[model samples]
Target chain A: EAEVAQSPRYKITEKSQAVAFWCDPISGHATLYWYRQILGQGPELLVQFQDESVVDDSQLPKDRFSAERLKGVDSTLKIQPAELGDSAMYLCASRPTGGLGYTFGSGTRLTVV
Target chain B: GQQVMQIPQYQHVQEGEDFTTYCNSSTTLSNIQWYKQRPGGHPVFLIQLVKSGEVKKQKRLTFQFGEAKKNSSLHITATQTTDVGTYFCAGPISGNQFYFGTGTSLTVIP
Candidate 1:
C-alpha cells in the first residue's frame, strides 16, 4: 500500500536551535495536514494545505513554526529557536480526492533539549 | 474553536473482554472519524461516520454516530492483545482544519 513518507524519524536539538521535518504525501492526494502530538495528548493541527495553497494555519505558531508545500506534493515543517515544550511528534497526513479517510506518515519525533 | 472529548482516558481490559470508547463534540460536526495509534506509532485511520445515526461495522469493531452528530462511539468486542492502543476521534471544524479528541488509551492484558 502507498504511504506518506517522512524524514528524520528521530531528532534531538538544543533549545533555540532550528529543526526541520519533511513529508512526501501519496501521489494525487490534494489535501495535506501537519499536526503536533505531544505525549499523552491528541494531535493538534498546525497547518493544512490544499494543492500547494494553505487553507488554514490558525493554530500554527507563526513566530517559530513554518510549513510549506511548494509543489502540492512533498512538504516541510520548520521550527526555529525550538523550545523544550516543542518536543513532540510531528505527523503529516494526506487525503485523496473525495476520500473520507486520511493516510498518515510515520511521523518525526522531535526532542528539544 | 471546537472541542472534542473522549471518555475513559485509560482502560485496561482482560483479553477476550469488551471495550468501548465514547467521543463528544462541543458543536455539531459534519462528520466524525476514528483513528488508532499504538504506543510509539503514528495515528492510523480506522473509520468515518457522516450521516446522523449511522452505524458501521468492521469485523469485531462497531462504530456509531449520534442523532445530533455531536457524539460518537467505538466498541470493540472480545478485545485482544492486538487491540491495545489509543483511540482518537477527530472532526473538521471548518474547511480543511480538523480537531481531535483527547483520546482513550486501551491496554489489553493477557
Candidate 2:
C-alpha cells in the first residue's frame, strides 16, 4: 500500500524561530490536506489543496502560517516566529480524486520553547 | 464550520469486555468515516459508511450509520488489549474538506 510521506517526525524550536515541515502525497493523489492535532483533540484542518491550487484555508492562521505545493505533488508548511501555543502534531493526508478515505502520514510533532 | 462530536471521551474496560463509541454530526453528512489511532501514531482509516441506515462489520468491530445520516456508532465485541486506541469519526464539510470528531479514547485492561 502506498503511504503519504512526512519529514521531521519531531521538532523543537525557540518561540521566535521559524520551522517548516514537508509532505509527499501518494502518487496519483490529487487532494492533499494539512491538519493540526492538539494533545487530546481531534485533527483540525489547516489547509486543503487540489492539485497545485488551494481549495480551502479558512482555519489557517494566515499571519504566521503558509503552505505551498508548487508542483501539485509535494507540499511544504512553514510557520514563522513560532509561538508556544503552536505546539501540536501536524498531520498530512492525501487521497485520490473522489476517494472515500484518506491515507495519513506519521505526522510531525512540533514543540516550541 | 462543522462539528462532529463523540461520546464518552474516555473508556476503560477489561480485555474481554465490550466497548462502543458514538459519533454525531451537526449537519447532515453525505458520508461518514471511522479511524483509529494508536498511542503516538497517526489516524488510520478503518471504514466508510455511505448510505443511510447502513451497517458494516469487521470481525470484532461493528459500525452503524443512523437513518438520519447525522449519527454513527462503533461497537467492539470482546475487545482485546490491542484494541486500545483513540477512535475518530470524520465527515466532509464540503468537497474534500473533512472535519474530524472529538474522538474517543479506549483503554483495555489486560
Candidate 3:
C-alpha cells in the first residue's frame, strides 16, 4: 500500500523565478528517481539517488537544477531562474530492491511563463 | 547515449479491439519495462521483461522480449476505455542507467 508522494501538483512561475518540488518515496525503498516529461514526449531521467548518495545524474542540467535526498528518505528537486523551456511535469519514483517495477507519484507540473 | 523508440506516436482504437506497440533500443537492454501514463498523470509500471526471447502474460496483456534483447512488444486484447493512456517502454543500457522510450499514446474511443 506504499505510494510515492509529491507536493505542489501544479506550479506557475515566471521565467526568472525559482521553484522547488518535493517527493517522498515509498517507505523502505532505497532508490529514488526524478524525471521531466514535456508534452507529447516520454519522461526523461533528471537524477537518481541511492540511499543518500547519487547514483546517476548525467542528464541533469546541474547549472540551474539541483536535487537532494537528505538521509536518503525524502528528496527535493529545485530549479533556480527557471526558463520557459523548463515547463514540464516533474515526476518522482522509487524502486524496490528487486529492481523491477517502479512506483511513481502524481508529479508536479511547473509552467514557467 | 542510449534511447528507446516506439512507433505510432499516437493510436486511436475502438473499444473491444486489440492493440500493440513496439519498443526498440539503440543498444542492448538489460531489462525492458512497460508503463502506463494517463493524461496528466505519472507513469505507472506495468510489466518487466528480463530474459532473452521471454514471453510473459498478464491477463489481456502479453509482453515479448526480442531474441537479441534489443526490442520488445506489448499486445493488449479487447482494449477498454480504461486502457486509454500513453504506453512507454523503459530500459537501461549495459552499464548505464534507465531511459524511457518516445512513448505511444493510445486513445480508446467508446
Evaluate fnat for each of the predicted models and list the values in order: 0.97, 0.88, 0.91
Q: What is candidate 2's lDDT per residue for A1-113, written digit by digit as tens?
A: 79999999999999989999999999999999999999999999999999999999999999999999999999999999899999999999999997878899999999999
Which whole-number lDDT from 0 to 100 does residue A31 have in model 2? Answer: 94
lDDT of 1 by residue, A6-77 (tens): 999999999999999999999999999999999999999999999999989989999999999998989999
Error of 1 at A91 (Å): 0.4
- Winner by DockQ between candidate 3 and candidate 1: 1
Q: Is the docking of candidate 2 incorrect, acceptable, medium or high quality?
A: high
Per-residue lDDT tens digits of candidate 1, residues B1-110? 33999998999999999999999998899999999999989999999999999999999999999999999999999999999999999998776567999999999999
lDDT of 3 by residue, A1-113 (tens): 78899999999999989999999999999999999999999889999999899999988999999999999999999999899999999999999776688899999999999
TM-scores of the models, in the given order? 0.98, 0.98, 0.97
The ten-residue window of minimal lDDT in model 2 chain B covers: B90-99
**In what order do the candidates fall by DockQ, top score first?**
1, 2, 3
Model 3 lDDT tens row, B1-110: 43799987899999999999999998888889999999877899999889999999999999999999999999999999999999999998635467899999999999
Judge the docking of candidate 1 as incorrect, acceptable, medium or high: high
Candidate 2: where are CA atoms >4 Å away? none
User: What are the interface RMSDs of all the models?
Assistant: 0.7, 0.5, 0.7
DockQ of each: 0.92, 0.91, 0.90
Q: What's model 2's overall lDDT? A: 0.96
Q: What is the lDDT of residue B4 in candidate 3?
A: 90
